[model samples]
Target: MESFPHSSACDLTAEIGDYQQFPNPGAEHAATERTPKPKLRHVRVVLLSFGLLCVLQGILNVALRLAVREPTDAGGTEQSCPQGWLMFGSSCYYISSQRRSWDASRQDCVQRDADLVVINSTQEQAFLTGFTMAAWVGMTDREEEGTWIWVDGTRVDKDRLQWARGQPDGAFGGEDCGDLRTMIDFIGLNDFMCSARNQWICEKTFW
Candidate 1:
């Protein structure tokens, strides 16, 4: 008697003489395909997790940007400055590359929502010093001769700040506008003509 070779468990489930019965020829393949594949399941899980992480990071960045807008009394972070501006202490500074008269420089700063940098401390003055050969500052005695004052209406303490030798001499009739200079034997603060063109520094506080 010759018997037929079986390829699957479902084949030849029953046999009688030369007659054969196959319950399900495709049952084995169907059982294997019903379940999710391990590699595909893992890839789906990884993609979902990555998407969640990206969403969380975006939310965190927005929160950080909106948390502290104003500077605190203690101190502030570097994020307070805008793009292309420099951060120092609790203020942001913008150094100009072009030369302009005192009034024009102030106007440019005003357009930028800032004003000529007011040297509030020796440290700040030092930071600004050497950065420019000559730059207009926020101080002047244009209102009252010999009584220098800042644009913010604060009195300029001649003793608190360093000035060039024999400065504010009212040279060439009168030199009322204040400027930071680094000329030969003429360094630190000096009184210059308001119409004289020069580079300038602008400052705006975070608070």
Candidate 2:
């Protein structure tokens, strides 16, 4: 047979060498150029799961709030305190233990989250004065010799005060202190000594 052309033989050898060296170029190139499908799918699944969990938590919170909500009363007001605390209009009252001076009693009330009693109206004053025992009711003349004032710095409303007979008499130099003195008729007065220890009524302003 005639000898083949040199260039053609060289080309045939090069082609055979290339085929042997790289038999699956398409597959290799596809693997290199494309991202890992399994890893991307896993990441997407994790992100979706986290988002769903957050949404569920938010929905649960709203449901709980709705379930536990309290209803408002006819006046659009809600009862603030639980039972046992005496409610007076928009305030709360607590009578502290007996056996403290007027100043000590005021400090005790302050420590207990309240202040000395402040009688606003005649009715309130009358109601408090009717108590059987002579308790402290927040009035005092400690600042001046005879100028009486409430612990909250309110001037005495003469009309509201129901003084017992012969009260504020400055007896035994006792006018400096004010107390709720109950006579046989159960009436009250701003009498008694500042040094005398007695139970005190505390008044706190609430919302």
lDDT of each: 0.89, 0.72
- TM-scores, all candidates, are 0.63, 0.57
- Cα lDDT tens digits for candidate 1, 32-70: 689878998999999999999999999999998777554
Q: Which stretches in model 1 have alpha-carbon errors above 4 Å?
A: 1-78
Prediction 1 global C-alpha lDDT: 0.89
Worst 10 residues of 1 by lDDT: 70-79
Please write out the lDDT profile of model 2 over residues 171-204, one tens digit for every residue.
8756576667656764666667777788777777
Compare the candidates by TM-score and give the number of the best one: 1
Error of 2 at 24 (Å): 99
TM-score of 2: 0.57
| Model 2 poorest 10 in a row by lDDT | 13-22
Q: Give the clashing pairs for model 1.
A: none
